[model samples]
Target: MEHEESNRSEFLVFPLSQVRKEGYKVTRKAPPSATDWSRRATRTQRGILDGSLGHYKGKAVPKGGCSAFAAQTLMKGTKPHRIRIEGMSITHDASATPDGIIDTVLSVMRYSTAVKSDSDERVKGVKGKWSSCMRKAGFQYASPQAAANDSRWSKGNVPTRLETSVAVADMQCKKKVRYLDTLVDVQSEYERNAIAEQSATLASLQSDAKVWLSNAKDEVNKQPATKRD
Candidate 1:
């Protein structure tokens, strides 16, 4: 039990950003604006003025409420469409444990690797595309690695050891469950102590009885001659 506790204390710390980088990237391209030339001209002007129309910039643009045109198209004369700001979506590998007691550690490592690889690929692809777009837009693009090395990204590693410790503890708990029935059926400490005391008392009584019988036989032998006379 002590050894198990010690093992639990040793955990693997992994960076979360590393895991996210290995996961997939969601590319969201808004539907092309309606084919009306007038609308297109207005959109182009808006994009240029608002920094949305040009080649993609390396920096993310803040998306405020949807445009009135988009709301009107969707609502079609209803109260001005309530514009909602959609949240950014992030992708990552699913967490799963491998079967078999001996395989648990290895399984965790494998899962971590799979997640990291997938995330890395996606991040790389996105960085590549972003870099190209930024270049076209006449903006300098920073490498994903550089961004990841920043304080925020540097802080993303997962606590791999902690995860391992949790797994080990869970496994230990499960093993304990298997023995629960037997443990429940076993005699209580008080009952066992009582039984031991009774056995000792019985043994002492048997010894005393033997001693008393031997003495009685000796007394009878000593009186035998007198009784004959």
Candidate 2:
């Protein structure tokens, strides 16, 4: 399963920007509720984060959501549609995608384990600063995710005033030390390093995507045309 995902990621041409961007850019700047629950939380907000708005496939899935893979894949698909829609009938113009290619352009694309490692490193670097900031603000949380899951706000209810307070405080501390900005800088630096590390593989993927898109267009053109009046 893991190998397949990495292989898929090689074909995945999406950026973190294209990967279902959250309102919060950096992990540390996120609110406590973001970790306590997801933006796609149930009314109770106890379920897992599945990247859906609780309404899916003609059902009110109060507890259900989409997988991370689906979220990443959908974001890549939507890149081509980032244009103004002028009519009810929408036609696809593939040229809108990155370089008019069918695939996405991943700068420092990594899969399963490498991605986990990168995420862990990013958090580990700034987590201490965040902890110190929280301690100064009269809180003793380890990280934002920990603050969100601190069990005080886990009674099948919405984000209460207490959660809101913590979230606000978290954001304040992060901003004070510029923790979020620093974290992004660090992550981007690592991203550049990783891209250089995997330059050969990334280059091959780019070539593959162009040919893949061209083949897709050829197959579409070969299909029979509909009869018109």
For candidate 1, write residues 65-183 as lDDT tens digits: 12422222222222211111112121111111111211332333334443444345443454455445444444343543332233422233343443333333332332333222222
Candidate with maximal lDDT:
2
Q: Write the per-residue lDDT of candidate 2 for residues 109-134, one digit (tens) a residue.
A: 43322354436666576677888988
Question: What are the per-model C-alpha RMSD values against the true structure?
Answer: 38.7, 16.9
TM-score of each: 0.16, 0.49
User: What Cα-based lDDT does every candidate model obtain?
Assistant: 0.34, 0.47
Give model 2's TM-score versus the native structure: 0.49
Supply the global lDDT for candidate 1.
0.34
Report the error of model 1 at residue 121, Å: 44
